[model samples]
Target: MTWLIFAFLNALFESLKDVFSKKGLRYCDEYLVSWALWFFADLVLLPSLFFMPIPELNARFWWALAIGGTLNSICAVLYIKAIKLSDLSITLPIVTFTPIFLFITSPLIVGEFPSAIDFVGVMAIVTGAYFLNLKQRSLGYLAPFRALMAEKGPRLMLVVAFLWSIAANFDKVGLENSSPLFWVISLFSFISVALFPLVVYKSRNFTGKLRRGWRSLALMGLAFAIAVSCQMQAVSMTLVVQAIAIKRTSVLMGVLWGALFFKEKGITERFLGASIMILGVVVMSLF
Candidate 1:
């Protein structure tokens, strides 16, 4: 399959993962869900290790994994926290900004530069996000920005977006130094280990939460593994921006999922912003 096709698959699976995470978050603590995500994903994917050869490691590769894994732990926890606090449609669309930040970060971290056209795309994405807060524009034209700041979920997701911008470059570096499958497993393992202490402190009965909600949490983990694996493979075959730009389409899918599954309101508004953002992402990645 083509690299873009893998990217589309990554989008599909990522949306599904968000939906699953939201479902599990209904009864499970965000930290438990976060920990279970890496735990079960690494667990299910462990079997594939036997078939894939371990790539030779270097100091640079280890550094990338450590830094990326640390940032990933932060994003993972905040991601679940975002979903827990707001509607999936409302929060997920903000993640499209990762590509916008990637334009700047990739140049510095990975030596990839963007053209003027890509800057326009970034503006389109910003405008799209503005549309998401039209409901609160009663105060002023700029109330959307204020509204986003007021809403903790959107705010947290935006932080996650910025962190992901940094992580994307590290991901490209990691893939360059290691195979996709190997990188996924290794990175997940490192994050899982690094996050253990935080998870323990976040939940007094973390193991009990896992035991009680194993089935739902396992499903969440499964979807996460599939999405990440597909994304890594897509990135290996193309630029990180290209893969992530396509993957941000998951925000659109999240809008639909929120409407269909959760019967969440504001679908039209979210869709307007999400569709435009996805368009901007496409323009940014391809041009």
Candidate 2:
């Protein structure tokens, strides 16, 4: 029960953080935003490292964090690029399909075969998501299909989803031998700190954009750090796959935010889709 609450709170914060991030991107360069976000998260993680035991550091832990951190940076870069190139509506739904990839990968990678009902839930989410993306064109409701075919956003999102699932699964493996939240966060922080010098040296225009994007980037980094910490902690305490399924509930929350705050219209189908996906989440949570 406690884990459930933690998961939900993590999801909620993540959803809000994404909203703020999208808004921040309006005036910022994607690369700069990415760098800033990572930098600040590392800053937050630095102090925690001082308190952790030196003996706790092991080759397995370092390797896991190194690999996972590298992959996650790639994930962040792809996501930022996608957001810059396409509509949020398109990118989010496609990425929200992580469960589909995870569902398939979990059994193969970790040897955890999901139940038949879980597969049904996966289908329900995909169908609902697709339906929600539907738009009315001259051909009538072929909008989503046309948009997906025309835009790189959806494709990039699919790729991001696949990478995130792989990274997430490996994260579970890595966390097994690691110390508490501090070291986990510290490792992530180290990864980010290592990247900053390169980011600045490679991109001269980054600073100009940072002037405008810093706050947004920092907020995203902080929120993301907290969300990630909560999730990593939650996974440590429970099942990583189930933790992922619950976290993906952000899709439903994103839909509501889009409808209410962004005033994005023509999304009745998305609401229905989110509702169905939410149902699957509930079932997955319960059984």
Candidate 3:
């Protein structure tokens, strides 16, 4: 129960982060903003390292963070690109199957075979994503599939989903095997953000935009840092698959915010799709 609560909170904050990030991305360069976010997230992580005595580091911890950070960087960049390329309604649902990627890959990566119920949940997620890609008025079941096949956002989102799945699968391994709660994240953030200066240094025309994006990116970093910490807390207390399934509710929240705040098109079908996705996640968590 406590883990569920933690997972719920994690989902909520992460949804908010997605909302704010999409808004901020409208005014910022994707790479520069992502870089700033990692930089500030590391800064937020630093103070937490002192909360308890630092423990001995292990190769697993470093490997987890390094690999997670690299993959996450790829996910972040692709996500922002998708946001720029498609309507929030379209792109978000496509990316929402990130957990599906995890579900499919978990067995391979963690060596745990999924139960029959897990397969059902994956099917539900696929159905939801399919509906989300269709036009609200089309009612044509194949329309979304046709649109996705011809579009770039779906392709980009697919790459993002795969990378995100890999990162998420390693999250638990990194958290438990790590020396300190915040140190590994801090290191990952530092290494990842170190690439931002290079990004900014390379772009002359986007300097003003980059400066403007810095503050929002920093805030995103803080939110993400907190989100990751909360996720770790949940994973430590509950089953990793259950925690991840619950966290997928963020898709519902993000789609809602996209419709209400961003005024994106195709709200009706997206809402239905989001609800189905949430239902699938809930079912996955329950049985």
Candidate with best TM-score: 1
Q: Write the per-residue lDDT of candidate 1 for residues 1-287, one digit (tens) a residue.
A: 59989999999988988888888886679988887889889998889999988889998899999999999999999999998998998899888888788877988888988888988898889999988877877889999889877889999999999999999889878988998788889988997888889888988787777777788888988988888888878988999878878888888999999999999988888899889888888887788
Candidate 1 matches the true fold with a TM-score of 0.93
**Candidate lDDT values, in order:** 0.87, 0.70, 0.72
| Model 2 worst lDDT window (10 residues) | 132-141
Greater lDDT among 1 and 3 belongs to: 1
Candidate 1, lDDT over the whole model: 0.87
Q: Which candidate achieves the best lDDT against the true structure?
A: 1
Winner on TM-score between 2 and 3 is: 3
76-124: candidate 2 lDDT, tens digit per residue: 7678777667655555766656767878778887787777777777777
List the candidates' TM-scores in order. Answer: 0.93, 0.83, 0.85
- Kindly give the number of clashing pairs for every candidate: 0, 2, 0
Give lDDT tens digits, candidate 3, residues 66-182: 777777777767787776676666666666566567767788887756667867877887787777766722847677777765667767887887777788767667756754365
| Clash pairs (backbone) in predicted model 1 | none
TM-score of 3: 0.85
The regions of model 1 sitting more than 4 angstroms off are: 1-6, 232-243
